[model samples]
Target chain A: MSTTNSRMSRKRFSEPLLGIGGILLFLLVWEAVPRLGLVSARFLPPASTVLVQLVNYLGQASFWGDVGQTMFSWALGLVISIVAAVVLGLMIGSSRFLGRATHSTIEFLRPIPSVALIPLAVLLFGIKMESSLLLVIYASFWQVLLQVLYGVQDVDPVADNTAKSYGLGRIARVRYVVWPTVLPYLMTGVRLASAVALILAITAELVIGSPGLGKQIGLTQSGGAVPEMYALIVATGVIGVLINVGVRIVERRVLTWHPSVRGEGIA
Target chain B: MSPLKRIAYFIGLPVLLIALWWLLTLGPTNFFVPKPLKLVETFWTVWASDRLWTDFLPSIIRLFIGLAASIVLGVVLGVLIGTYRWLRSFTEPILEFFRAVPPPVLVPLLMLLIGINDQMKIVVIITGAIWPVLLNTVEGVRAVDPVLSDTTLTYRITGLARLRYLVLPGASPQIMAGVRQCLSIGLILMVISEMFGSSSGLGYTIVLFQRGFAIPEMWSGIAVLGLIGIGLSFVFRGVEGRVLGWYHGLREMQRDT
Candidate 1:
């Protein structure tokens, strides 16, 4: 038993170490290729150079401004969508009638890729922060709303009826019965939507030329700051990594009492 | 839930919204906000124009080619990763990092590397589309029935034959789901890549119209994109249904029992 426990502990510790080793090996290969003159270091700047530039950018206020603007749009859009989706999702999801009424509209609106609506957004609100907000809110709304609808549909009919029979009011039944069932789905939807919100926020910046890291990337790339461009790209990627990890952590915490969370990813 | 009532309810909201839009925009507004009727006319004119044929085909083709390439790459790479335990653990962080990088953000780098040609656009699409399929394929491969693999092993079956008969079929349903997701992402990247310095595709045309201040035409362009999106997904669903009919049958049967 002791030996088995130690083996398990060692295996657990080694997994992330293995991941780190892989990234290190990747960096080494990246560093070696440019140094070997196989590929021009100009186009694919050495990983070391990119890292140095990234460190330099960390000291710049402009970099933080870009990061802050991107995060602000992401957070604002996500919050708006979550609020909109939850309220509308709850209202629409509460009845078979409401769901059916909105079926055609939702189906039509859902597949209209938010990016494709860029020109429309630009038309309504030019290349501004509001454009990013529009795209982000539109895209993320569908992601969460659909999940919430599914959550509502998944509520046990018997439990709901029992709550009603126990003289619980609409708000109480929602609090005790509906919220528990919907919470898990909400968390999952939120986790998925958070990534999407960030994507749209950056895409809006990149395509619409709104202010953010994406705009900075385009500016640097065109202005002959290749390493800085790559560094900015890496910064976006790091933000992406942090967001994914953050979402997953928040999800686990929120859904700690849920069996599904405990049983995630069998292999 | 009468059929007539259901039909009325289903169509009512959208129709009302459209009417409201047409009504609200009846008076003159900004040049950008054209009446729906005018926009529809513009859309009709644009669709009938020769550029629609020229621009639409390449974008659609890029979407398919990139999606197909990614599906192939993903399934192949995913199977290898799933089968090899050590490699899976080692590659997880790299994959996760790459996955987080928004697909559009890679466009500039790809454009520099490949030039702003169809090839560049296609490569961007592949980069964007690959992650979903690859991750799904890995998950699917891992979820392949243990009994099937054990049986293959016990029978001394190995390599290609085992993969074909056991792993592929078991993982196919998931692979199809991944393919569906890849289609959407592929379309997105196709537009985004074209939004770069490239001059030929729907994205280019839309941006051109907007910058040129062809507001009605620009509106039409966006409408057409939405049509294409809806059309493609509907087609994809039809194909998914056909391909995964057996899997669906098995699931339904299991549910019954």
Candidate 2:
């Protein structure tokens, strides 16, 4: 038993170490390619140069301010979308009549790419954070709303009927039965929306020159500071990965009772 | 509610929205929110001048060329990776890294390297569109039933024959989904590439109008693009439904069981 426990511990530790090692190998190759001048250093700078530039940029106060603004807009947009989608989804999902009535309209509007409305958003909101938030909300609301609808649909009909037979009111039935089932889907929606919200926020900044990481990258690129541009692009990539990882952690914590996670023993 | 009443309720909301928009802009304090009536006028103005068609055609041409190239390349590479375990393992990380990098971020670098031209726009669109299809194709192929694969092998099917007869059919549903996703993404990238640095296309027209503070004309340009987006998406959905009717029937069977 002691030997088996030790073996499990060793395997657990080595799994993450192997992943880190693979990542390091990739960075090593990236660094070496420019050093060897296989590609023009001007176009694709060494990883070391990008790291140094990233550190330099991080030291600036404006960098933090821009980051804060971007995060603020993203959070605001996501909150608004989550609230609106959940409420609307509940109303629609609870009523077959309503859902059928609105399905066609939803189908019509859902496929229209939110980014295509940047011009309209810019005109309406004048390149402010409002514009960015509006675009993000537009992009993310449908996804969450659909997931919530599906979640509500997936609720056990027998459980709902049992609650109804117990003389529970509509609200109570939803609280006891519907909400729990939908929570996992809501979490999934939020996870998916985080990536999308980030993309829209950055795209909004890029197109309209709103103050964010995207604008910084665009400025650096046009100014011919290729290394700094690459560094900022890498920073954005890191931010995306970090958000994904953070969301996954939250999802695991919140969804501990979910069959998919519990059955898989993912903690 | 009855079906007709339900239809009315849905249509009523959008009608109300349009009415409110028109009412709010009736005596607009700002030019940015042009009255809906004036927007119609601006649309006709552009339409009569033949500018819309001239600008729209080039954009459409670029969109199709980019989409076709990406679909071909993505399917070929996705198949190679999906079929071969070693290739999949080798390329997975690199693909993930590139997928995380936003396509618009690559526009400037691509422009600098390849020059600001139609080629650059097409390349950006292709890069943007290819990832979704490639990833989806890989997933689709991976999800194929092992039993069916073995059965095909037992029948002496191998290589291209196996792929054509077994893998491709099984993966068609997901591939179609990927294609639908790519179509819209390709359209957006087409516009963005043009807006950022190009002399032609609807994006350039909108940017020009916006910069000049031609609010009515800008709104008109935006409206045209929105209509195009709606039209293309509808067409793609029609094609998808036709192609995936068999899959839908299978799904119904599974659900019934």
Question: Taking chain A by itself, what TM-score does each prediction score?
Answer: 0.96, 0.93
lDDT of 1 by residue, B9-113 (tens): 889999999999888988868676789888888888887788757998888888889988999999999999989888999999999999999989899898777
With candidate 1 superimposed using the best TM-score fit, by how many Å does residue A94's alpha carbon deviate from the native? 0.7
**Model 1: which residue pairs collide?**
none
In model 2, what are the clashing residue pairs, if there are any?
none
On a 0 to 100 scale, what is the lDDT of residue B210 in model 2? 83
Predicted model with the maximum lDDT: 1
lDDT of 2 by residue, B57-159 (tens): 8888998999999989988888888887556665666677777776777788788778888899999999889987898889889888899999998999998
TM-scores of chain B alone in all candidate structures, in the order given: 0.91, 0.94
Write down the RMSD of candidate 1 (Cα, Å).
2.0
Q: Native-contact fraction for each model?
A: 0.75, 0.32
Among the numbered candidates, top TM-score falls to 1
lDDT agreement with native, every candidate:
0.89, 0.83
- Please state the Cα-based DockQ of model 1 relative to the true two-chain complex: 0.76
